[model samples]
Target: MLEISRRGQAMPVSPFRKLAPYAELARQQGRIVYPLNIGQPDIETPPAALAAVRNADIRVLGYSHGAGTESYRHRLAAYYQRAGLPVVMEDIIVTTGGSEAILFALLTCLNPGDEIIIPEPFYGTYTAFSIAAGVNIVPVTARIDNGFALPPLANFERALTPRTRAILICNPSNPTGYVYRRAELESILGLCKAHSLYLISDEAYREFCYDAPYVSALELAGAEPNVVVVDTISKRYSACGARVGALVTLNKQVYVAAFRFAQMRVSPPGLGMLLAEAAAELPESYFDESKAEYQARRDLTVARLQAMPGVVCPRPGGAFYVLAHLPVDNTEAFGQWLLESFSYENQTLLLSPANGFYQTPGLGSQEVRLAYVINRTDLAAALDCLERALLAYPGRTEPPLTTTEVASAFTAPLLTQLQ
Candidate 1:
């Protein structure tokens, strides 16, 4: 038998997709599955972005500059400048996607066995990425009860160690949809500055910030050397397949180091560069309609979840995701049961088990993250399936029977699994 690398063995699986085999089996059995598990947007990719590929004259499909095409970088820089991040083309290095940018950031900023502080229930991929980069993740737990707000400065102070090298955050976060207040960002940046630590911010969902203004890590005054932003066009333009993202920094040293790593990969995706440049050309007003649509969907999702007994969902300020506690014991088992055993009107729903989002053991066992990316009609249908499933779910830790439920001996026994 061949031995595998220890690092490869330790890579965490994606919570969003880990149950895909169950979903496939459900589909094969003729059940319709509405996957609310992943943040793959159902919104149409901008026509301009698609056209850039369809209309391009390049026959060779050759490699672009390792730092990405200079023209594309300029386009990205201009787009950032409008967002109030004062960056030039030289300040950015395009990568295959946000994942690659994160890799660049991690590899450049921290040594193997060094630690990067990240809040709990963060983007799940960060765990895999850190493992791949040979870095240790130090999680400062943030409570779901507080809408996943940033833990206080003292929390960061307490987590610090000699091996700590950086902190990573996702604004309008991926799983919980929590947007960091500017003051929170400042305080975190102050911690980084005080400790001479790097701050890597994943701003992929910036455009979808619904309630409050999105604050980029770049906005903090005089912390250029301490801040690095990882960005992507996936969610912004509904162009996940484009695979274009950037590592942005005003610090010359970090930029140079990340660029060197970029060269080793030859270049970022070529066609993606074209697609992103086209997307960057889109007007700022484009986000307005998209934001409104997502905001409405977010409202629909939260309202539906809140109405369910024993469900606790905090209204998130931004992003298209909602992290909610269900009445179940282990959400992974519950999610699998939804695909394997339950259906309403021949329909089933897929959900991301929230435990995979946390580095802390057993933290998200009772939670699930739902993405409200589908349009209202489909979203409504999916939520309907979820509600009925929860009412009938056998794995729930306790009965969530209501007055109406108590009135029905039918619902009461099912809620308690007494049958």
Candidate 2:
């Protein structure tokens, strides 16, 4: 029989969506699901952006320039500049989504057998992309006690090997929501410069920072050649359906190479670019209102999680996610039970099991990542379900893993099981 390739066989299933079958089963049984599993926000997309698509005067929806239409790229450059990144039209390559941009960065900067280092409890897709690119990931562990701050520089230094080609970071990180400050950025920049390594900074959550000012990798002076930023309108504009994003770098060679890869995909979505251009021109007040809403949601999420017995959720500085350590022995089993067997007022909550976020095994088994994308009412209901689920879960464990235990677990060898 013909067989799937090893690469295809080794691809990991997304922990975020793997239990979707159980979620569907619950919905079919007439239960309301408070979805905290993914990052799909309920915020409205800017009216102007929607209007632009509605009023388009195109005779035919033709493919745009491979890099992106000149007009859209120019507008995007301006948007980045206004947001404090020193970007120009030439530095941008429009992508199908941030996922494509990440794949492009990995493929362009590293060859097969090359290695890239990432912080543990990162966006799970990073592992999928690295596998697709035939690249290996070396992970450094970050602590939950400190809101998953960047692992010590020494940890990064230890993970480096002769085959290391780049270091990837998600500022305002996806699973952890820990935003890196300028000092952390500089420390990583110093390492990249010293080792002549590429820095792929995924700043998809740049606009959602609640507490601290965001410092883009693009803002790192004299590190232009080393920094490649992967950004998207999905999170910023609450337009995940648009599927528009960009790979940006001041380095001419990287930009040119990425442009060539963009050519292979022909062009990004035409209508999405039009929408993104209009989004670029939205008034500052648009973000002000949106950020206020998300901040309220984040505040509610952290507070409620803190109130839950046997739950430890540190306040995340940015992004809409918080990683909470639960008293359960296995979050995967507990998550499945939440959908299949547990509910409160006929409502159950679905969460992304935190284990998938870590490259190292046995690190996140007792944790889960929650997205505060829903409104306060629904979020409160979800928290209610979670609290009850924890108390009733059969796998409940007492005295949650201490910081010392967690630190030791980080050194455990990677497990072969995907979960």
Q: Estimate the TM-score for candidate 1.
A: 0.96
Q: Note the Cα lDDT for every prediction shown.
A: 0.90, 0.90
Candidate 2, residues 88-166: lDDT per residue as tens digits?
9989999998999999999999999999999988999998999899999999999998889988999999999999999
- Report model 2's TM-score to 2 decimal places: 0.94
Off by over 4 Å in 2: 399-419
Off by over 4 Å in 1: 400-419
- Count of residue pairs whose backbone atoms collide, per candidate: 0, 0
Native-to-model Cα distance after best TM-score fit, residue 394 in candidate 2, in Å: 1.3
